[model samples]
Target: MLRHQMTIVSETLMPADTAPSAAAVRSRVTVPLRFPDGYTATAEVLTFHGLADGKEHLLLALGAWEQALLDPEKLDPALPDAGPLVRLHSECLTGDVFGSQRCDCGPQLREAVEKISATGGFLLYLRQEGRGIGLYSKLDAYALQDTGLDTYEANVALGHGEDERDYTAAAQMLGALGATTVRLLTNNPDKAAQLTALGIGVTEQVPTEVHLSPANHAYLAAKRDHTAHTLDLAQPAVPSHDEMLARVDALIPRLRERAEETERIRRIPESTMEDLREAGVFRVLSPKAVGGFGMGVETYVEVVRRLGRGCPSTAWTVGHLIEHVWMLARWPRKVQDEVFADGAEPLAAATGAPVGQATKVPGGYSISGRWTFASGVMHSEWVLLAVQHGDVRLQCLVPISDVELLDVWHTAGLRGTGSNDVRAEELFVPAYRTLDWALLGAADNPGSRIHPDPIIHTPMATLLNLVAPAAALGAAEHAVEMFRERVLVRRVKNTLEDRQADSPLAQARFSHAYGLVATARLQWEEAIRVVTASYQRRPMTMTDHERAAYRLSLGLSGTASAEAVRVIMAGSGGSAHRLSNPLQRIQRDVDVLLNHPTLTLDPILEQAGRGLLGLGITVPSF
Candidate 1:
């Protein structure tokens, strides 16, 4: 059972000029506090004015019993007169109200409230958002933190102190609340010392439990190391996939820097490739038994999306190479052993078009043809060539030594992919090196029997086709970001408006484009989730309708991305057409990407319509 009663005794609004002093009492209200955890207490909510920022603030004095109106002249006889628990919690709208995982503020606040409810104490909810920098500036600091700055550093970058909060208002509130001596609930010793200096006796300091989480682990660590907060920094939690994404995100700057060089040379720069390899970009989709991460398809796509945000070309190449590892796992055990023998990732490039001729032999097939648009061939050790042996289509794995590279990729966009032609002249691939296209499509491959991982049994066509649109989504998102930055400061050359950001048209365009991009991303993610979920189920199977719908959703995502880029380019003005402008390049890349056979919107929609109508699928593989 809980017992509490709350009522407002008075309400008043003071003018800025007539605001009460920091120690001046304004009004008092009784607040019946009840937590979800069933802890209940009655608190006298005192309002004060003329704080550090000259704003009204609040202090809640809670007790196990009801207290009289707050007065500085006398202490509540029912409340403890000596030591009492105190919490000086700053206000955090994001963490407290909205439950943002970016910080431990909400959890700390709740913990403080719960403790104060169980034991008699005060919880001074300071009106300091973002460490006394205010709400908007705090949000600005968050943007800086996203760019690889620690919380304190971000505040410093925004021209604020590491600790901008002053304890004067809190001390005054405590004095008025009749808290002469206190047992502070805080991790910072400075808080206790400051309160003690302000004439309050800190008899004891109770350390708050560290609310450790992936989002705020680094933040907590920063407080422990730099701010001298008492936190055990040792034995940090294991990194999650989100942390892996953060690691990839940290490499975006380098990838962006090398984008032009990659395009100029029609290949990913050696340094950039090495960095990506070291980052485990190529091993994301590989089997764990063979020293691979064996991440789910959704996570793999997300990684590719992040990489694409930095450089779509690099993202495309990396996605293919990583996905090829998954495909290789569908081959025979002998082939898997040979491919992963050294435990080093063998970068592989693949082409799905069965343009090559394969002559059936006793042990294998003799393949001869030129495969066009083979991305990442420049750096790959092996090439998965799609060849036709009689009436059956086969994916034959051949070493780079068996193929001749032709520098034939000349494109307006994605030029960095180095998707050139590879010619194989009578290259004899052993039986173990080839996988039947039908078996792979049905998720019934030789490798699935040996390696019991359900992901190995995923439908290959849908998995491979999904990567291109993921890269396109990244590029589209980048275009939106570029446009947002440009429009904020850019102005109409002769117009009265000072900035494009102030223009209604610019605002509408940005909003529409952002909506399109966000919707596209959601569509892509949901599609990947469905596929990965199916893979997790043993003996994964996809109906014709399911397969067609997946392809259709991917195509829609690609088209949506292209539409978003188009909208941004249209609103960006003439400067966006320049070669140096990334918008134009992104636009071109999306255009070329949408033209991909699997990602083509019209055909995919038609196939989906056919599948839904119970007709034959135009593209049976997908």
Candidate 2:
């Protein structure tokens, strides 16, 4: 049974003679938190002052967490204090703050808050989005999860390991919380080791288990297996791939329709986009330098996978837009100061296809040409028009006012993307505002010269390539949701057979699709994790490029999404083929996503295969 009381399992332990050191870290680095719709929050690091080599370090008064932010020592002045309840809860903007049903993190956080409030404990909520992988990868994972891989396996399939989180900073925060000993509220054992290694005493473990919803039971299992969490489960019997495909084949038509509806509306009416936004979807690519929530590339991949489960367009737009912001964030402070002189609402777009030109002027260059396939153009305050200048390709940021948007994004899929063409007539862009395209792709971007890190300058190609996979995964996830709703009441064809939901075949397909999403998500996250780690340590290297390639391989889950669509749609039969069927629309969306230049099968294969073979890859392929 789960206990609600504060039961002490061990005596308090504080390292004696370990006084707080005089070394001060300027914790007041200002991080500008950017929100969707362009709202900004100034995050001032209230604390970073600390001492001691691990054991009993202190960083008092961090972010204003639920008005729950308070100095731990102030709560209890007793010498060396009994310590606050140091909770290293991962950032789950949607569930914890907004209460989404997709996962248990939100509920668990609420429970922890209630417990901590009543019992006087400290909660250190790290800004680690999507388990430190990032939003894009998480969304991709969601798509894989829809395909039936367990959570751990899904991350792996997506090129990630089981878990990618660091607790050292969390430990520092704990010390700042005036916590010498803590009863951690967690199921993962790794948290315990991390804290202990950091020289903090984890006296007891407070188990915070969430009841599994039908939608997330497999997810829980994956966490237990892959992340080494303390959750227990009995593996179900494995079924053949043929049976799995047959099951999903039946539901495609309805899924296709639902996907189309989501895109046509520009917003998912059934689900709240606000919820996703709060989940840190829009901040995945934020740079650590600014006040934006910084997430590694691979983790972002997983974030997008999860969002994809709810709405593809939201995932796509958020993922693509954030990556663009990340690129801008790397610009020299002077450059950022100049461009952002008007504020951060500059609308920017990219046409992956090389097709524009610029002439060098005295102080800058005049750019003119028409570029298509620019996502988020409808809402951009700045535009990144790629143009050929002399011998090099450059990405010039032109004010939205200087560019004209052409509504040319008429298609049968991803309709809500609002991707249109941007036409400019000899617009003068300052030299500093222009990023050499070749340099940008070579991981030698001008922003990198300013920020000087591989993570910042890695080619836009590597990052942008993930958009289609996430979109496809999202389309497939809609199919799963639709199937779940209809399976119980709908009956399978044949001579008086069981309800479709009751069929073993249905269960198998649903479960399998779940795994695929999970696997894809894992792979995507792993890729970002590798990149982020490298960023935090030394600058990025060829290893980072390999990680990017791995991300591409996992993002190829569009293929799996397509397969899932085919199976689910076929299972629904001819009635689903009608244009009115949601499944048909999902199919069309998947088809469109597959054909997207980024998700183009041949290129992805070539890039990934070349990397695996240890061959040199082109500048932007990663």
List the candidate 1 regions with Cα displacement exceeding 4 Å.
1-239
TM-score of decoy 2: 0.54
Per-residue accuracy of model 1 over 1-622 as CA lDDT, tens digit each: 0111111111121122322233546777998876544667677788865455566678887764222223311343444444577899989999988767788898898788778766667889988889889899989988998898999999999999988887878876765555556778999988988877666777778898887644676788789988899987443232358876887898899988888788889889998886876577776767767756666776788888998899999888888888887888878878888987645367788986547999988899999998898988988888999999789898899998889999989999999999999998888898878888888656778877877666777777657787789999999988888888988999788777899989888899999999999989988976786687677766677677777677777888998999999999899889899887778878887888989886887778888888878897866566
For residue 67, what is the lDDT in candidate 1? Answer: 29
* Count of clashes, each model: 0, 107
Q: Which ten residues in a row have the lowest lDDT in candidate 2?
A: 2-11
Top-lDDT candidate index = 1
- Per-residue alpha-carbon lDDT of model 2 for 393-498, expressed as tens digits? 7888777878888877888776766788888888888888887666666566666666533457665555666667766776687776776776777876782656
Relative to the true structure, candidate 1 reaches a TM of: 0.61
The CA-based lDDT of model 1 is what?
Answer: 0.79
lDDT of each: 0.79, 0.61
